[model samples]
Target: MDSNDGFDAATKMETPLKEYFDASTWARIHASLQGSLTKRGAGNEGTRQFLDLVLLKAESGIPWSDLPLSHSKIHNVYVRFCRWTDDGVWPPVLEAMSEAPEAQRLLEQLVRNHMIFRRSRKFRSEILKAS
Candidate 1:
């Protein structure tokens, strides 16, 4: 059993099994998620990448070997799959795109919609006016 092969790097460098989050399909999903989605353990882009792969598995079907180490590793996994159900550290860029002009229109058309609000409306308006 040579651990120094390339197995470690193979899964490490490669992205998730599915393509749930991409520019072409972000608006619909994000809005469906209610403006933004924060998975339980999802943190940074890597976690989101992993979750997207998990998502693909749920939608289509995944080969056991393709799952992450947490789901694949027979010994012990550093991160688990279910831990990140909905937290808040996923992708802001993708969320922002859901609110973009084009995407916003599409999102409104769909049942799900992104509700944008400002904590301080007056201040925000002033800032916008200044800019």
Candidate 2:
């Protein structure tokens, strides 16, 4: 599949897929991610674009290296994915987006199956600060 397989400007400019997330949901995710991850560099691809690419990757269940250049560099996407996973950045975002019953069920399954982490001191501190 092309890197931009499911996420192109034309597609985004039109209606977004409600099954995944809407534009406002993406905006919240992007803002939260940026605020939480300070070292995130401002890539040419904006947070929305990056998120679109990530969603595409997740939905397609493809290897990170398979991401197309039209999205972002595979290396960058992989690095961000790792960082986000390690930093416990995704659970909250998923929780916030789980408004629909389907989304909530999916989030529940994901957490039930794969959500396990020992909180680092730094991670705890960040959570406290956010509170």
Pick the lDDT winner: 2
lDDT of 2: 0.56
Clashing pairs in 2: 3-68
Off by over 4 Å in 2: 1-20, 41-45, 70-72, 100-131
TM-scores of the candidates are 0.31, 0.52
What's the CA RMSD for each of the models? Answer: 15.2, 10.7
List, residue by residue over 5-119, the lDDT tens digit for candidate 2.
Answer: 6666522233342236676765565565665666766233455555556665555656556555533466676666656666777776666565534554554444333334334
TM-score of 1: 0.31
Cα miss at 39, model 2 (Å)? 3.9
Clashes in predicted model 2: 1
